[model samples]
Target: MDTQDIARPRLSEEDWLAAAYEMLTESGVEAVKVMPLAKRLGVSRTSFYWHFTDREELLEAMVRRWEERNTGNLVARTEAYAENIAEAMFNLFDCWIDPDLFDARLDLAIRNWARNDSNLQAQLDQADTRREHAMTNMFLRFGYQKQDALIRARTMIYTQIGYISMQVHESKEYRISLMPGWIEVFTGSRPTQRDLDRFLARHG
Candidate 1:
């Protein structure tokens, strides 16, 4: 009707979800309410209703997005083609360094949120299992025996989880410096210079 009204950008579903994700990362799920998110976006609270039916629906959508982007994408990358297990290790390492592929902030926030909700906790557990299985299959594809693949996969996945849970802060250089040794420990074979170079070209 007015110039100001016309000038206000029409909000999309993604805009509300993005704001909610920021709040969830900053202050956990309980802080992801409609009014606060609306205020954060500088839009009317009614705008959210057009995108989400209620706060619970918004929360579910956030969880679904997390699953699709983080867990689903990670598994897909892990299963990507590699000449050997060492190259496969590098493929999976991309997930750790690439925020677009795996968001540590969102992952940690959801884990924290799960501590208080049984339903969410179950969902998190399922996701963890799926990830572990995917990693195990990667090793299996590289000719590991079933038992060995399962153990190695558990070791790799759990170590990453520990890094996230402990909130370890280290420069990327320092972290990448440890990858060679870590890959050896997880896969039972040292990374070749070519493997190291490939990883560094992307991450270093």
Candidate 2:
């Protein structure tokens, strides 16, 4: 291994993963190329191969990291909420819908990559499951039965994707804020400041 390769081992796995996505957010999927990524880390090319087999493997690792992140956020946020539908649902949406919270570029890159790779499709499905499961639990708080919750969760997941899937030229902040009103139409209750505060006071 090169001396730089030895130094590369000092960086935590999370640090490396974050650097990869930070690059992705800056330049798109192509930014994560092995040689360039190694160079970006001030390490040798062999350093990357030591941690991952190849560029494709590293991309998959990145995908896995993002999937766990969204899944973990969903699980943690859902468990923290009180038995209030509107408040819980708003919290749930905030997890994925926030502009600064999630990197929309990450999903856009994966969706683009999926057009040429079947494997990426599976990773996309995993992320979808995470969101659906989390939102389903929120629906349960809103008085929906398991099956009904599952259906509603699926809808919520799609609606969320559609919202985020807007063109890069569109306003992300505006898109994130637009969903709550429609959510009220779908769920029959708009979350209010008082309701959210009560739920937070109980659950927070």
lDDT of each: 0.89, 0.67
Candidate 2 whole-model C-alpha lDDT, 0 to 1? 0.67
Against the true structure, candidate 1 reaches a TM-score of 0.93
Which residue pairs in model 2 clash with each other? none
Off by over 4 Å in 1: 1-7
Output the lDDT of residue 140, model 2: 81
**Candidate 2 lDDT score at position 104:** 60
Could you tell me how far off, in angstroms, the CA of residue 44 lies in candidate 1 after the best superposition? 1.4
lDDT of 1 by residue, 88-199 (tens): 9889988887889998889999999999999999999999999999999999998999999999999988898898889888788888888889999999899999989987
